[model samples]
Target: MAFDAVVTDLDGTVVRADGTVSAATLQAAHALSAAGVPLLAATARTPTGVAALTTLAPHLAFAVCCSGAVGWVPGAPEPAWCELLPRAEVADLVAFLTRELPTVALAAYDSRRWRMTATYQAMRPNTHKGPITVVEAAALPEAEACTLVLGHPDRTPEQLVAALIEGGFDPTRLGLHRAGRRFVEVTAAPIDKASGVLRALRVVGADPARTIAFGDMPIDTTMFAVVGRSVAMAGAPPEVLAAATDHTASVEDDGFARALTALL
Candidate 1:
């Protein structure tokens, strides 16, 4: 079905192994924008990670970042609105994770830049002061980072995810997953990409049946299940492939572009 809007996951679904979107994909985004269709970036990536892509399309609206902690609208030059796990809760969670799973990495975002408090070196090696100013967590003062990444790159996030759960963190309070072997994340309850995108769509009065999404992991399964039309990456997990309503090319093949253009 042709869609009125499109939302896409980053990483293995939209970005190629080289960490770039295909020219055809960018063109497809522009085509949708020029036609007045709203295109949104949906990812488990924090807002900072997706910030650079805001300029990808002039017609792009808010991004579903940090798995939806922030409804980032760079178009406003300032963020429009956001939902964050409370600072105190974040601090407490960090403290809890530290005492129990001391080796586990932890981080949070204030909607402008990425920050590190634990052991995430996957990002550009940089330093900044964060809100709490605690010596334990790296702080980024004036850190206008959009995304907050957390993980222990030395170990598969699956290990830490298991550790965190066994350490006493209630599953109902938050969610956890490995972004790749390189990273794992924990976010506020309901941080799944599908629900996040759904909330964003509701705010704009978009209809689910008219919306199409492209994704490539278990994290995106929620999004696929809810959208009227969802496409899974050819490279996605076997489970994701089984769950998708349709399947498309791999990220290298411009899966998102193919799906969007067909809908358009």
Candidate 2:
């Protein structure tokens, strides 16, 4: 396919294990952009996290943030588009989660800032680098939010997801997916990486059949489904690997850079 756009996940696809973008990956991104291919970072990260990526790759003008609830362009002040959960629903979910998983930590984010419950800060120290307001769970403001994160250091993501389902979180009303081994992200229903990719395509005027996507997690599945070429990283979970059209080397092996080199 004569791909004109590239979308990649951040943590395990393009960014290295130590939370740095490799030189090769950056070069590949530059090469793609120089060749007229738009590069987008599709991730579950909030705008704060997306900022770090945009700083690294200025050519990357677009990002799918908050799993898919927000589409951001750095320096734009506001997102290109945003989807927010209802205030009442946010309050109800907070109350429900607190009742069911009292020990779990919770963090909520809008487009700009994060409000982390005291328990979440205690559970995952130094997880977020940007300014975070520590608040009580019961005091969590009833307001529009882009994403809510449930963190449990001891439980697997699958277990956490099951727990949320058991807590009466209707899938039709929300998007629930594991972002990592211990984090399950909650967003507005029908929002995900694929939806974000679609938004990016609209902004960039790229055809779905002419877009290439790369990811290494289950959250990336929707993005894979939307693109013509889906490349999963080596050593990804079996389900993620199965969801992709092809497999590439692991991030540690510079798989992302290699794949881009071959494609661009």
The candidate scoring highest on lDDT is 2
Candidate 1 lDDT score at position 76: 59
Q: After superposition, how far is residue 25 of candidate 2 from its true place, in Å?
A: 0.2
Q: Write the per-residue lDDT of candidate 2 for residues 136-199, one digit (tens) a residue.
A: 8876645457888888767788888887788787888889978866788888898888888998
Stretches off by above 4 angstroms in model 1 are 100-102, 122-135, 138-148, 262-264
All models, RMSD in angstroms: 3.9, 1.5
Please name the candidate that would achieve the greatest TM-score relative to the true structure. 2
What's the TM-score of every candidate structure?
Answer: 0.82, 0.95
Q: What do the candidate models score in CA lDDT, each in turn?
A: 0.67, 0.83
Q: What's model 1's TM-score?
A: 0.82
Stretches of candidate 2 off by over 4 Å are none
161: Cα error in model 2, Å: 1.5
Q: How many residue pairs clash in each candidate?
A: 17, 0
Worst 10 residues of 2 by lDDT: 48-57
